[model samples]
Target: MPRPPYLGWLAATLVGLFAFVIRMLRLGEPGEIYFDETYYAKDAFGLRTYGVEHETVENADALLAQGNHDIWTGTGDFVVHPPMGKWMIALGDYLWGLLPFGAAMSPTGWRVAAAVVGALSVVLLVRLALRMTRSVLLAASAGLVLALDGLHFTMSRIAMVDIFLMFWVLAGFTCLVVDRDRMRERIADLTAAGQHAAGWLGFRGWRLAAGLCFGMACATKWSALFYLAAFGLLTVAWDYGARRSAGQRGVPGRWLLFDAIPAFFATVGVAFVVYLASWIGWFTSPIGWGRHWAAENVTGIWARLPEPVLAVVNPLRSLVHYHAEMMNFHTGLSSSHDYASRPWEWIIMRTPVAFFYNGDETTCGAANCSRAILAIGSPAVWWLSIAACLVMIGWWVTYRDWRAGAVLLGVAAGWLPWFTYPERTMFVFYALPMLPFLALAIVLALGLLMGRDADDPQYSPRRRIVGGVGYGVVMLLIVANFLFFYPVLSAQIIPYEQWADRMWFDTWIYGSSGSG
Candidate 1:
């Protein structure tokens, strides 16, 4: 293998460090549970203290503020989501004495895990870009753009599961990208040696790693299943491409048996096992919601099973039932929420969620002061990314550029499924998992702007300068856009009119609606 890119890590580390500091700054200032943190934060506390979610008192948030963390009623709460994310949040609460909710309550502690993961995601994106493009500048640029994206920035600072879900999805994709290169190299070596059959590529480390990451993603949120399916198919396609490139006859047939089938086990099968295991807490806890489901239905063949087999089958069966109910809830959820948004508008961030907001007399030292957390995307980044996606569609169709296909696949995984649930109340934050791919698309587009070394022979220096200028302008606009909205994203108190100025349209509102 060639010498590793030593400078790549250094650049990624610096960008990641910058991201970390930005996310960590004033993280605890809000000091109040916001948006879904109300559910996740309390659920974390429950799991930490009682091994499962326990029902909280009606006024639990108010009580927690008054130093009463003993707000649970000791009854099992039927939480809709899985437990791994809660376990992660619980880790922070466990270390900070907040699980016990003693006199000292640290909101920053609740958000520590998110800050760390969010920073690591930037490093991961940098590595992915470096591997895909083999250009240190373009890779670092991807990391910088991701770091500057307002939605990525805002979500990173808050204690939410979506960022963790994004982390795992990106990690899985990174592993798959590595596996793609590895397989290509192995196939090329075989073809050069006059070997037509590249049989049983020995234990693939990256593919297995991707499986594990996808599992963790599912453990975070069920929506990750869409990604699992999308990436699984992409992996198979890569295998077919590798075989065809190697001059193998009947590439599709050979790849189906030799690659796709094994890949199914490597990714989907492993993910399923990991997902089932994530429910261990629910399985073991006596009062866990739906734990008694199988026992309650002892009427049919379930009654004839031997006690030991019954013991295992019961919980598994019950888990399946719970999933059915959860799916039902998700599909039928049409309740209108003030901050809810449509999937089509998500690309342009037409309706961003308001995670938190407060208006007070003294905070701004003016007639009105507003401190808020709006989950808005950088307008420049989002607008350009939409164009980049369209460009990728053409690139994929005309050139069969694997990079374009990979990115568009990711966007589909994170986005297209939501279109099916159009009637469901969705928030812009649900689109968090797509940001990395959008950044990647922009990177690919940037590569076009700054022509590759191969293209240097064909291009005039004047054209190169124009491309460079265009790239710089977009980056500057992205940074400037992020800075302009940083106040609202970070909950910084500002004069009401100044806050209003940041709202580019009437849709950007405060409180229940989108007006700023």
Candidate 2:
């Protein structure tokens, strides 16, 4: 009933609205498919046309622009990732590209979905920050930081699936936090009711929702499996902690029976079901790549099943076989890329992926012109987050702060897994899914510096003023940094000198400046 919460939501919504409008601005620039859009945008169009993604013919971009929708090469493509994200992108094409509302090949039509998902991420960060920290300032700050990050901005405007992956991972993490709170509350209530153990909290809907979100995340990219696994274990830990706090006897056994078992069914089990369901388009299509693998190569268990059972099981078997092939591709994908970066370098954004660049252009009314879309985070937010992450680790170690551990785990789940594949061709922008956690760490660290509540007489006003001013200055810096790189981030046609000047490091300059 308090006015502050309402004001907080208003601020958050306004920030997200700003993100959406800015992302939508000049979204059709360069007016051609470039980078990974060549793969995803066309695949999205195919998904809209057929039940599955089909291979595209050459000059697909120009063909689509000429209103030629027959770009598919008559067979399904062997895309590694699942169909969930392409389906999301296809929605934008359906609304904007089909009805004379916009050109079929308009960049705006395909990119709108990414923009919307990116903006929604900002809103989710605000809600999450508010949940963790009651202060509206912290919540709004986290949203603003993400809104201004160049990596987020560029990813928001592209048709690539990483933005959807980021959105779903964040959603799942948020849902798990809610589930933690719900489970803890149930424990408190039951323990107060003269009971040593809190029995099963029927079904735990939030955990199930978390599973669905994580399933969508994994369905977007198999890399999301890292977060799904990490978060699944984290939720079980939360359950154990909640039971121990409630003074339950045989807490380990109680947690396993009442919480851990259901948590698994709600998360991992449901996630497997949803992940399998996401491939239905490919599974049903007769000509889909690898759809007949199991039927043709059934050798296990003597292949003794009846035709009906074989028919039913063959689909699932083929899906499993496809996944194995995809995993092989992922592991052996060490093919060199110009913008590839190591996991260590990604900590400081050493090598940002160039999403788009105008290689030979004279459109800026200058001797030389460049238009680019560079994927990099705002330096102020990202650099500050390094210290913030260290701070969170310390808090978790020293005080065993659950909030700090949650933030650290979120970042780790999104990150660390990449390091295991040191030879993998990875780009700095692959770190996108972890940005929300970094923002949370930054805001939380700043909040700690801001002393305790203003109402607490023991809190130092001087420290509060220092932290508040420091936070404001950081916000200003993030905005200024974003503006300075806006031309490169948004693929704006600018003088080559201006674009080069925006390039902070040699790695950035070496990356594509929309020159492709």
TM-score of each: 0.95, 0.96
Cα RMSD (angstroms) for every candidate in the order listed = 2.4, 2.2
**Per-residue alpha-carbon lDDT of model 1 for 62-163, expressed as tens digits?**
998777887888578888888888888778656655445322245787787788889999999999999988888888999999999999988887777888
Clashes of each: 5, 4
lDDT of 1 at 77: 88
Q: Write the per-residue lDDT of candidate 2 for residues 236-257, one digit (tens) a residue.
A: 9998988888888898887888
lDDT of each: 0.86, 0.86
Deviation from native of the Cα of residue 204 in model 2, angstroms: 1.6
Off by over 4 Å in 1: 1-4, 95-105, 454-460, 510-516
